[model samples]
Target chain A: MSTTTPPRPRRSRAERYRSALWLLTKRDLRVRYSTSALGYFWSILDPLVMSGIYWFVFVVVLDKGGDIGEKPYIVFLIAALLPWMWFTGTISDSTRAFLREAKLVRSTSIPRTIWVARLVLSKGLEFLASIPVLIIFAVIFGAQANWNLVWTYPLAIILQAILVLGLGLIVAPLVVFFRDLERAVKLILRFLFYASPIVYSTLDIPAAIQPWAALNPLTGIFALYRSGLYPEQLMVFPIVMSAVISVLVLGIGLLVFRRYERAVLKEI
Target chain B: MTEPIISVTDLGIHFRRNKARRRSFKDLFAGSARRSRPGEFWAFRNLSFDVAPGEAIGVVGRNGQGKSTLLKLVAGVILPDEGRVRVNAGVAPLIEITGGFVSDLSVRDNVYLTAGLHGMTKAEVAARFDEIIAFAEIEDFVDTPYKHLSSGMKVRIAFSVIAQLDEPVILVDEVLAVGDKAFREKCYGRIDELLSAGRTLFFVSHNERDLRRFCSRGIYLDKGKLVLDGPIADVLDRYNADYNNPTP
Candidate 1:
């Protein structure tokens, strides 16, 4: 019953999906960096400049030297901002995941989730590359580091990746349906920047509002990053809340994506 | 005698009058966004057809009659709103503007990325890399970004990649209609080789000589309905008569 077909080995669906995902992630990174000779340096420039501005405003100008962070406040500021940039960048790009790539989105046979997941991976890599900036800052500022960093840093990365991937899957498809939601997401990110514990530690939040603040998943992620240098910033309650919320967001994201995928395809 | 490799049953897709406009939040509250019934009409409804394995089918139609939409449905890119398009084999769609590449990627990366997107392994793409590049006649621009390429060059790359695909069902939607005369001839020759090897083709084009060269069976479409389906010469005759005798 068989006609003579090509003898090439048929790869499993998962294998093909994985390879396609990696190939696309590589493309994103190359496109963002390959054209610029100082890609890595320029990529980290935004967070570095932001840290400096905050340091100048709070530490130098206001003379609140001890209030901002531990000695060499720049390390503390850079630690939280790097991951924040990763979070916001992925979510922002997610708005256009289907719209910007409509042609390929409608053409390729690859699983659609790869489109969202690739953004998380590429942005995560950029965040990872900027970690050395924190390290060199730590050495220069002499920020205290505990042996617990070995586990906490990587744990935070895994959590952030899951969180962003879930949010992206949810955002990318929904924006295809509601184009205005793209601008809505931008507004939310702006609020989230001040709302998240990037400029200040979670410990600094008023005791009355701390419980409500724990609802923000990032309160815990930032704690994990900061806990590497300042042990007091790590709180078990918010960290546990973040873990639960990250997993929950991912579950909801998958459902939202599956429900609206067809409509998204049509809309795009 | 064999089962049809592709089956379309009561297939329909709809378009809204204001499909270009996203529903406002007020529409969401008013519940108008939830209903799929209003301000919409089927582009093609209750359509049924099938293609047998290794069958080379020509789909001839005037502009905007749903030919390209049919190929999109078969390729599983656009979901059918009513019935379904069932194909037993993998579909390799030779479409434009979707070489399955990020526009910023280099030609070399795009070649690998696109082929991989369709399930071609790295080793397989590696083996055909030089062949694809040489066929496209763009060895000099291997490292250049895809967005910088001329439209003709884009078509060349798309064809080169799709031609290397092992997928049994190939959808060619006027892909050969573009590019210069010499390159188009080269593309036609490649298609001829593939057809001789028994690949299933769904070729759509307005060019009669080109259609006749590739297809033994033709289906003529007008007003989003199948007007005639028969031997190539007969279908071509009906198409011409309809063209000459326009509706008032």
Candidate 2:
């Protein structure tokens, strides 16, 4: 007897979005902590350890203290590090995200955007896991808290996520073509670490170069994150500009990624 | 017979090659150097085919003959350099069984990930979770990391997820050759079920037994061109005839 199946309709956009996001998130969370003793603890601990080292270097060794009006250096550093970690981790991992899934890319006909989005979303969750520590650090440092901080912090995360997603969309596909892009991203992240106002304040830059620093999308995100932890010392203009730039970057990145979507599978 | 679910026309894919002759230090100093041969290759050229819904088609060709490439194109994993491929329904390519599975994740997690990659929802996967594990027969290893599982186990889990996808069109590319006899038989059974459900299947395999058993129609590709398209038995007869008596 002949066993035959009828052609099923393609999934709608909403169904695709829901399925893709859930699967990616579950895979990321489970796989990341799999076969490890620490498991979920590592996500929380990774940033804590890094923050500790930076706090020691900047607070003790450098012995540099600047109120920046209200917030302490340690508080500022932790706030900056949280989002910076998310940005760096997302970009670095995303460079090889598609290539690592070469098996999937070459096999299935699922949308490529789903893969890139999964990496960004997973990193975003990891970023969220580091928040309690941020709060604990803030309370220990005697930083003032305000409701505005809540609004600003999430905004910062949203903006940074947009920027990272855009950058990832561009980088993930390119890395498939030029395998060296993976290495290139690592070098670029190191350079970006210093260029961004992560360890040092953007205020530290000379007046002549402050405008250029203001132009960086990350600078706005970092500023907003800091403001969220300490609202009184917030800078409004750059934060707004950063939000605008993040949206623009994300939009352009998605366009480029979708344009080259078909080519990526073939090349890989 | 229904209208073709997949249609391809004037498809071509070209690969560029840099044929610049390698010049030594001595050649660099000397102005007289011959140009190298042009480097260009076509993986597929002007290929076209139409596949009806619920039809089982077999793609047979020698290595590097663009059989896989053509499959990839029809699956929409890649686009053609020229021409077009149009599919009226969902296309699931079974080229790699373990596509987005993370070794660090459990077999349970990998199943969900695989289902997700094929565009199934969490609730949907959850509903079929028991059935999938039962089919794979890895209930004990469901919580274990995929990296810890044997290759055969991995294949089983991967196959189970794809088998449950319920996609309209399924593309199988020599993946069934990896498992043990029992497991292979189980997979064949699943394929039989899918076929009975009237699902469209496109398979690429060198196994004559499988080709004759599962496929109703066959297309013989040689050097990226369609050399034969007819009933499965007739195509196999011609293929065997050519194999036994190759042309000089």
Candidate 3:
């Protein structure tokens, strides 16, 4: 309505991206902790509690394997669960990211990309918060401390983030058009838990189907995680592949997301 | 003299509704025939307006009118279907008072977050933090989660944060109707301050009193087309006359 020129030029992509990421991360942290009495403890406790349940199932009930060469089953599960939690959390949260913030999407003129980026970054922070818990579990179990573990651990985290963000961008917008996609994603994630190498190793799959297992992005990510938590094992190629696939999925997902972004806001 | 800060020419928006019979799964494989519904519906057609720096204009109409749609287009929240909006100045839209605030966040944190989205640096917000809180009159609840606050509290906090921004042009929707009378008066006072400082304001409201008090000029939009644009008193009189006497 007012015709005065805005003081500055259009914001650059880097500026918008950084601002969006910061605002989203701040909102996530503030909102998550604001109402709760326990606050920051929830971040560490969620993964720890989930790991305990899995420990009871895989280590106690099944007793399939223990401490792959010195790493306790609890340590192994915690390590893998940390990244898995991040992946699943990001997928679920980012799926509803745009829809849940429809008011912001409809009211303010901030770029829509911020919605997806914020959701991903906030989940990434939660994943980072769980790292200390993973390290503590490793220390208690006397897992080996190798330089390879340090380097590979960060690589796996980055890959998991990309894969989740990419998948979120692709699926979240589709959710606006097909309401059933939300339910389908939940069902698929449940199916993928067992399909993924979360509870067991890719080796458990018959050798004839091992190639198909490699196609699951989580398979490569978990394999890399196991290798880092226990450097004695070999998971180099799987980690590399996971990183590559994550980048590709993210790139393609962003393209699709941007293409449909205008409609997504309208439909929602 | 400076160029007009806001330029909109031949702006139009249409929403299309699809009424084709959905194909069943079996019919999909069998290539069953389908019939299409009516074509697109025009929400607004061939609308044009311009605003100069430091001008205060009011947009008024009844519900189901295209006032909100035009505001959305101006704010860039939604794109215009057929035409373009060229905004030369920064925009601060108060379309939904608490649009940016996450109710789960504390008032203080929401202020920082909202300011950050407006491209304000953390340090700048920090400098204005106290002033914003004081203006909103929620000093005691600044640290509390916003979700726990009453609707009035939320609006107050949101308005306070918005008032601190240094944008050249501000777009205000009818959300000011939510706050208490005293608070609403304060909001108008703030707008008066902005106008006195030579900032342009585009306000949309159903209240004639607000339009008369805050705006120097008025634009009447009926079904997305501008019907009248001129001095506030004359435009409002014409709008009232047109409303009182409808064309058959």
DockQ of 2: 0.42
Query: Higher lDDT: candidate 1 or 2?
Result: 1
Model 3, DockQ value? 0.35
- State which docking tier applies to candidate 3: acceptable
Candidate 3, pairs of clashing residues: A3-B5, A3-B6, A5-B88, A5-B89, A6-B88, A6-B89, A6-B90, A67-A71
> i-RMS, every candidate?
4.2, 5.7, 5.2
Worst 10 residues of 1 chain A by lDDT: A1-10
Candidate that beats the other on DockQ, 2 or 3, i.e. the better one: 2
Best by lDDT: 1
lDDT of 3 by residue, A143-225 (tens): 77677777666777778878988998888877776666788889998899888877667766787887777778888888777
Please tell me which predicted candidate would have the highest TM-score against the true structure.
1
Per residue, candidate 2 scores C-alpha lDDT tens digits across B123-165 of 7789789988988889999889789999988888888888887
- B1-248, model 3: which lDDT tens digit per residue? 57988888898876545533332335323431122224556677788878999899998777767888788788888877666899887787887768888876767778888877876778778977898889889889988877899989999988887777768888989888888999989888888887877889998987788888889988888866788889888888887797874323
Per-residue lDDT of candidate 1, residues B1-248 (tens digit): 79999999998887676777676666533643335657776667778888888889898888878888888888888777789989888777897535476677789988988888888888888988998899899999999989999988988988888887867888998877779999999988888877877889998988888788999888887776777878888888888787874323
- What fraction of the native alpha-carbon contacts across the interface, defined at 8 angstroms, is recovered by model 1? 0.53
